[model samples]
Target: MSDVVTCLWGRAGWDRAAQGLLGAGRRLADELGGKLRTIVLGPADEALVTAAQAVADSVVIAEDETLAEYNPESYLAALTAACQKFAPRAVLLGNDAYGQELAPRLAHRLGGSAAGDAVELSVADGQLRVTRGVYGGKATAVIALMKSPGVIWVRARAMAPADAGAAGEVERVRLGIAADPRVKAIARHVEAKEGVRLEDAQLIVSGGRGLGGPEPFQKLQALATAMGAQMAASRAACDAGWVPASWQVGQTGKKVAPQLYLAIAISGASQHVMGIADSKVICAINRDPDAPIFKHCAFGLVEDYEKVVGPLAEKLSRHS
Candidate 1:
């Protein structure tokens, strides 16, 4: 057993963010000369176990039918128990909705500190340091945690996914789950989405106010379909009701780090640019020569989006 322990809390299906957390946990374990343990709540699933074993040194499963659906109170109670028993040096969670709520509460229970939306993590001289954006993603700040069992909420697409390695052992843990009368989850509704998920897409085609209206988004969607990419929108487009809120991408929306990001008619506001700062390449299309997106993009086309988007879509569709 290692003196230092790094624990990662994973969801059932193991989405990209979960994979990223596992990858980050593995690296942290290596850095601290510790062991990597993944904690999964819910019934046993082979796929979940397999995914967890790909990167973890051990998979700790808290099996229960009640865990099938997400209940923040129940999850918090289970996690609190696990952390107490495991006494990990660090705990990592995704910076998603659940994590945003759980991390701070868990840290409070553990008498430790919590940090969210961490883009970079490192340890030196027995202190864990995290780098993240501040001021609505306008700048960066590095935070150092002096306490043990540091709780970190990792940002999506910030860390590299862990490659397949030696399989890990699976351990089962039991925790008492009590229902909270304060909150009850009556129903769950999932919105239907087509094509690739925005966060998981390697290529993203985003539209902004320059598209004129929602009807023009169809052209962008066609381009996205042709390129096998996900379609996204700026806050302006979402606020204009041209697209669903789920399609928005910015500091106020989902953060993306696609390999290639296409910004059509977006003015590249600071809030919007902050989300795609990690994209490997950015291509901007706007009619205004002085559009702010041009400065931050690798490729720029100062042509009317109406004239160019249709042709571009056609070209890609033919090739595809």
Candidate 2:
């Protein structure tokens, strides 16, 4: 079997995180003395193929009617087929929902090892090692996968996207995989969103329970709007019904790695800090001087949010 490092693309198509996977995959392949391959689900248009071809040594398109809807079973089957055909040394998937569900199952089907939510990867003594957060982001742990075709789902914004240059091979493979009859997608509800997604936001303004109630989110939103940043909430705010569940960011919610994360009135519990661990710069403003958030922030201000938010919003609006 030829040694290869494989990365998978999801149903929605190639995103920044997926591009980051290519960069990571390319590194893994180089360390293993192998080639980098990418498997794209559904139809891959000319633009998609051209883009992927620039980084990967080869690209495999797994096209099937069942692949249109994101059914775990169909995806797993197609991915299995690709792995069997490619005989990769390792398979990298995104840490998002799609990869979280498929990585383990694909490993089980292929009789290999599996790990998820990995932040770092490396090859030592020809074995694949994965580094990930543990204890709700209080610490980190590293594990080595001894099995062939080590399956890993990488965290978002783990690294920069692969630099494009290679003129790689491209081919399409049809896997006659059918959807699982037991799990029919009867309906789909897409959350309406504006501006950049939380995972993809460069600047983020997040709030917490200390804001006292849902009304404070309006002020936070105003600041976010003036700064052209996305708004997020801690679990407390979401649990208190102050914001939509989709806006929550924490261990139990979404993980973000923005360039700047401005946390207002947040206590910065470990679970919440876990989500923003990858953020480049963290800033906190809380009335409580001893709030846990101050410990983790690069810059912190101790002041009542009511007194600080209005002026901050006004100043930011003026500057904009």
Best by TM-score: 2
Badly placed stretches (over 4 Å) of model 2 are: none
Off by over 4 Å in 1: 1-12
Cα RMSD of predicted structure 2: 1.6
Task: Give the Å shift of residue 37 in candidate 1.
Answer: 0.7
TM-scores of the candidates are: 0.91, 0.95
Against the hidden true structure, what lDDT does model 1 obtain? 0.82
lDDT of 1 by residue, 39-59 (tens): 887665677689888888888
Q: Where does candidate 2 have its weakest 10-residue lDDT segment?
A: 1-10
Error of 2 at 283 (Å): 0.6
Q: Which clashing pairs does model 1 show? A: none
Tens digits of per-residue lDDT for model 2, 1-320: 33555556544456668777888887777778888888888766777788889989988887788887778888888888888877888889887778888999999988899987888888888788999889877788999998977999998466667789989998877789977886788889998978788998999999999899999999999999988999999999999999999999987888899999999999999999988998999999998899999988999999998998889899999999
